[model samples]
Target chain A: MFGTGQFQLYNPVRVIYGKGELKRSAEIFGVSNVLVICDPYVSSNEYFKEVMTGFNSVFIYNKIIPNPPCELIDEIIESVYEHSKGAPKFEGVIGIGGGSTLDTAKAVSSLLVSEGKLADYVEGKKKFEKRLPLMLIPTTSGTGSEVTNVGVYTLNDIKKPMTSPTFWADIALVDPVLTYSMPKRVAATTGLDALTHAIESYWATSTQPYTEGLALRSAKMIFESYEASLNGEEWAKDEMAIAATIAGIAFSQTRTTAAHAISFPITSFYNVEHGLACALTLPTLIHWTYKFISEKMDDFVRYVGFKDVEELAKRIEHMMEYSGFSLKLHDYGVKEDELEKIAKVSVEANIINLTPGNPKYEDVLEILKTIY
Target chain B: MFGTGQFQLYNPVRVIYGKGELKRSAEIFGVSNVLVICDPYVSSNEYFKEVMTGFNSVFIYNKIIPNPPCELIDEIIESVYEHSKGAPKFEGVIGIGGGSTLDTAKAVSSLLVSEGKLADYVEGKKKFEKRLPLMLIPTTSGTGSEVTNVGVYTLNDIKKPMTSPTFWADIALVDPVLTYSMPKRVAATTGLDALTHAIESYWATSTQPYTEGLALRSAKMIFESYEASLNGEEWAKDEMAIAATIAGIAFSQTRTTAAHAISFPITSFYNVEHGLACALTLPTLIHWTYKFISEKMDDFVRYVGFKDVEELAKRIEHMMEYSGFSLKLHDYGVKEDELEKIAKVSVEANIINLTPGNPKYEDVLEILKTIY
Candidate 1:
């Protein structure tokens, strides 16, 4: 609880959560002609159709790709323009899927109002001046993108991203019922994604009391519920959904660190699920970062209900094993030579800046080598 | 943890916490022409002078009276319009002081943008639209008004009246140094105000998972630190300040209930400090509410580190005794005849709707009788 401390935590989205909150989306969105964005899987779900019954004027864009490619966003913006009669104006934007679709919705809404290419707005290059009313409904419980002021998108053949205080969702509808339909593998990967978010945000260089409190609670929830949720236990699934969303909000504010940074390259190159990719590096990163901030690690371990840092790291490894995710980078088809390229790209990633204890490039390489 | 079903929680105001965060106010505010609405005490503090140093164009409105009056807010708005030559249009509004000043700042900013009287926009009649960019810096660490979407002001000859969510501050700066200057009595009463907020919000009808988590943390912090902070202990003071603000944010989302409703008459009639007045009825309300929601009370008791509900009630009694606050209605010069009138007023207050375990008028009367 004590350290060389100063931090800021702020989340400004109104969240409505429960079993059937999706029913209220139309009312919540008001009279706006909404641009409804989702993944192909989500767009075809029975639950999605049920939720969309009353929303007659919604324009569906189900082409959102993972990592939210910049071109996909441009396509959505063009669709919005054509559908809205060349005005490119939507009364509101509704994203109803996992992080990718939600991130795409945010980027499209921001781009719809701003006067520039998507790359011009990456991470503090320019502040977003205007955005349509953006509402997010996170069906997967990972990527708290619904309530965070961040939208992570791949740009210029790189996983570079941008964050602006202005990029927040106006309303976030998190219905646990939406999460109940997820496959076991989807549940596990997303749950691990949320866990990584909570753990990394708690230890990020910019962690604040507000975020720390949230991240701790989220970690505790995930530690207790992630496995149960994957096993299709109802109570645990409900808790996991809540925890994932909360952790998303937490990391969205503080930003993820080395594990998330290291994860991007792995996910992009190896086609690993984003959550699994992040989870793979998490245990090693935690062990390494623990050496620099041992006391904070102790707090984190205790907060997450582990007896010690070693126990926590072991639990993370066990979770990855349980998920059947490949433990070694080589198993994901990474060549021995690509490690250096990843290290170079990762060293420049935003997560490198967010990583607390400031691990050097050499330290990063060593961790990657061990995983390899 | 299991009984109370589903709820939503979201607050999207970035909180910057530490010593010297006040100096960064200008950077967060992003404008030079700032109107600083503060109380006389806060206006005179050296720390406030340090905060003011960052901005060249600053207007000071130091007439914030206890339980701020609506007319006073009108005066401040008129002054802002008169002073700034209508140029920058008050790029930012800064509130520095206790809840009254903070509330005044909220009201002023909200009113500046809206097209009607302040009272017309108190939750029901009209939705508050158009508020200038607002920042709040609380000195007392009580009221937690800095981070909340609430602004309490005296309205229609009533005390403890509040405006709606449109009053949410864009930036809530919680600098421990600002709170270090509060007088012991002020610290005690305001800290209790925060404690009441946490307790009441936990039991609020609208209490969601998000607010509940924050409320529980806030209650734990207040119970552990309020008394020590009252005695002018430095570390405890800091914790108490942070706790109070957190509680404010918690309760601001989920408004206050029976105890807060009961306290208004006491403050209006006897001029008791808002926090102490609210504290007087808390134990009685908690004890009564426990009968309806024993499981929830048990959770609260455990979270607050009490052995049971009895111990929790006793601890609150001990806090009042230690802080030298009068617990009896008689001490505040109320007659036996006033009890019925007070109960009538309490029922009339819309806050009765916020009471979680809805006590009947007789139940309310019984709680009042115990305090009396």
Candidate 2:
């Protein structure tokens, strides 16, 4: 039986998706005064020149680190104030990079209207009353942050996410041409990250019929074409781009279940890439989550062209290994004793309860040991 | 290759869906001065009493007939004026029945401010400047009319659909409990109607990845459980309700293609029920459309658990026959010579161009003859 649940969907973000739809950015973003947020790598690239063409005034903030810290956003907030001294007021923000860039853009948009820093609002000390409009052009396919209404930033030395409908972008230009420059290794890990989102969300306790449709299609697209995407098939890049955004829509409604809940501490403590950290635990998590709901597990395997859940997990592991995502816990500078602490931290995360039934601390510890 | 296309999704409708979500209608619609739209059968039901509970001024307009004509809508327009003589102006419209009732409600919402008649807006002579807030509680599983932005009404003696973004409902409270009392004959035809929507929309030339995901899942659900839903299975009723709504969303994005194009004349001329008319020719249309795109056909058959396109078509025919949807054109009072006009009129619909390739008038004629 399809579970009875109330799906509250209110995505007001307009999306313009195609191979070369970025030319319409000026029309979609409206006014000319805008802040362009990205990393130093993206600002140094050639496409940045085209992106800066339409705006009358553009403030560049390129200090975002991976798993972006709140202090970096505080610095950018200072930079925006510095640039606004003798110019027209900033009307919007344009984010054009990976997850951290988009997240920082969203955070900066929210902070401009609210009091204090980003942490104050995130920690419940303040609530934002309004926000600057946002438009995102993603250079990477992994984060799905362009469409989702959350920003993942490092807070108090651990990666924390702030969620509210105010963070959704007004326009997301998902041009596949922007993703061609992503490194092969980045492509693999991010593709796996999207795959994990689709799979974990398919069986989440709160998974509804609408999200199920998206999760199924995402799983089919990523599983069929991710390896080819790693090898740089042009069409596969487009499919992967669309698949990642679709997976984001799937999990954004239900939130991620087990694998995502378990990945935060690994990325924070060991400095593993966010997508890679999520990718590492996904195969084992799939094996574990399938034991709770066998029917859905069977459907997943059948739809993705596998005979059983074990085959599906092994396929994911093979894809990860082929793409250079195979590193032991020790490779990330984790000692043997650190595994238990990591497991405990993952269990304490609020998203852990979003999974089906009660996945005890003991269960997470076992899964960690197996992955290690 | 996944065809390069833009997925412009911006659904701002707040959907509160569950088993008993109709109780929150007062909160969602906001003001108490509301108009109730339904059929005679639905207005006499016990749930109609519950729908009228929290309204200070409520006007009931239950004169909507099947294959709804603009003349009847003109009468509804007059009745609404008749009721507004001494009461506070109706601030909102609450549509609580099948497709005709919901379409009438949406049409009334659009007509509140527009000059002249409904046909003027449909024919591009006038446009709706604003609409009354609409809250829809669907009592049938077919016609994804609740979430869509178009109202199908007969204009100038031909069934015409008025298209606009302004027609989308503010709130769609999809409660499956309201659908359990559907008669078996209604269940069969409407279930087939939804299945056709899913299948036809999947192959539309403008179909995007997101709508394809919704269409595929909807097709799977309706095809799998429609037979059981005809037998009055409780779980099947719930599945059909969700599937039909999902199909509505799928077709709403791209609109329906050739089968829907062909079915309109049958519905308007032969006096066949709207759903049943679409159901009549769907199987043969599936067989014909499959010959054009065999790879997608293979995927559709495999995913829906059929051996081939022919097997899928046969399975559809079997389901229709069991649901009492089998009848010849002659049985509906169409002479053999009328077949040419029916086929010619099907070709004239704007939606026929939405099909994948050039499906000529002769192709439609052959398919109609085979189905006949």
Candidate 3:
């Protein structure tokens, strides 16, 4: 039976999706002067100039680092102040890049209007009440940061995830043309990230019918398009672009479950890419969580055309292998003895509590060691 | 292949769904003084008083009529003004009961803040830019009016459908307990209305992946729960409530297709209920549209667990027979010659153009005669 639990669904971000739709950014943002936060690689892309053509004026900041630090956000804000004489006059803020650029843009937009450092809000010392009109355009398909109300920033050498009402962008422009330039490795990891999001959101203890429907559909598309997307097929990339955003919107409501919670410690400790780190544990977690969600897992398997949960698990492992990544945690430099530490760190995440059957430290350690 | 056409998905209504969520309306609305628009039947329900227990004060207008008219809304505004001595002071507007009550409340809230008669906006003479904080509670599983931006109102003896940004309620409280009291007839018709929404939204030429996923999932639930819901099972009713809202959100983005367009004429000409009127054409149109959307319809059939589109169509016919609704329009007082007039009227609705293969007057007439 579908669970009869109470839940709320609200996503205010207007997602405009299509091929080559980036050209309409000026019309969609409906503003003139704007500040754009993007990755350095994005600024040098051949098609970048055309994307900014309709804007009357723009402030470009392309010094985005992965897992953006709070100080980096502060530095960007200070530079904006120094450039604008402390009276920044921009009608909107646009985030254009991967997760780091988009996450930084979320903080920058809120801090420009509110009084505090990014850390103040990240640390829970303050709340963001409002921000300028904000738009997020993802250059890669993996980080649904463009549509979610969540932002992750590094502070004191630890990743701190925060949610703010203002972080939900006014518009999420998903132009698949932007993702066509991703390297094959980027494609694989990010594709896996989208897949994990689909599965985790589908089975999260907080899952509702609305999110469950989205997750099922998103996962099906990812399974169909992951291989073709890595081969640089525009049609497959287009499907992946839409699928990733749909998955993002799914997790945006349910948050995520053990997969996401576990991925955090693995990424923070091993320097593995976020999506790759998440996928490393996914196959094992699929088996581990089966007893708790057997019928639901069966439904997911059937809807996505897998024979069973085992095949679903093996397909993900196959995707990882095809992408040239070893499935074992030891291959990523994790010592077998360090499994307990990863488990300890994973359980510390608040979201891990949302996992079905509520896997404990020992359970997590067992799953980690199974993969190692 | 999934189409790469452009689309925008934005639903700002916070849908709070649970078995007994109606009691928390006060906390969710976060307002003291409120204007309530409800049906006369609702005010007499045994649980009505409990729903209002947490409110500071409530001004209830319960003389709601089916197919609410423009004069009735103007009268509601006049009564509020007369009661408050020229200035109407309400922190929010709460709409309870069926579609008519909810649709009336949407207009009352917007006209109170923006200005002019409801007709002024319905006739496209003016626009509504804002409304009081609005909350909608569905007492039936059909209509899905609570979550959608579209509202139908009668003006000058014609049903006019209008959409505005302000009509999106701040909250949609879908408490299945509120639907527990629906009569068997209401359950069957409303269930059919929801099923039609799911199917039409899935096959509409304007369909996108986001809505297709929702439509598929919702149709599955409706198929599973419709018969049991008619038997007054609470679990089935709970599923129906969620299914209906999901279908509403699906059509809210895609705006529906031929079945809905055909429905408007049938609903207006005959005194049949809106849901039944919509479903009368559904099975016939399902077969008629199959050639144009064969693969997509196959996908829908497979996902919803039907053998084929023909089997899907037969299931709807079986549902009508079980509900005691006649399969022929002649039984509803439409003369054989009137089929032409109904067809002429059906084609007049612009939404018919959104149908796959774009059925014309002759095509609609054929489908109507087939159903008869």
Q: In candidate 1, which residue pairs clash?
A: A10-B14, A11-B11, A11-B12, A12-B12, A123-A162
Task: Pull out the clashing pairs in model 3.
Answer: none
TM-score of candidate 2 chain B vs. the reference:
0.93
Q: Is candidate 1 or candidate 3 better by DockQ?
A: 3
> Model 3: runs farther than 4 Å from truth?
none
**Which sections of candidate 1 miss by over 4 Å?**
A1-4, A50-56, A78-89, A123-127, A231-236, A281-372, B1-14, B51-57, B75-92, B113-127, B283-318, B326-356, B362-372
lDDT of 1 by residue, B13-117 (tens): 767777777878888777788888887777777887877766878888888888776777777767777776674366778888887788888888888877666
Which candidate wins on TM-score? 3
Residue by residue across A104-183, what tens digits does model 2's lDDT show? Answer: 88988878766688888777677776789899888887778888888888888877787877888888788888888888
TM-scores of chain A in all candidate models:
0.92, 0.95, 0.98
Cα deviation of B370 in candidate 2 (Å)?
0.7
Compose the digit string of candidate 1's lDDT tens values, residues A202-227.
88888765566677667877887777
Ranking according to TM-score, highest score first: 3, 2, 1
lDDT of each: 0.78, 0.80, 0.90
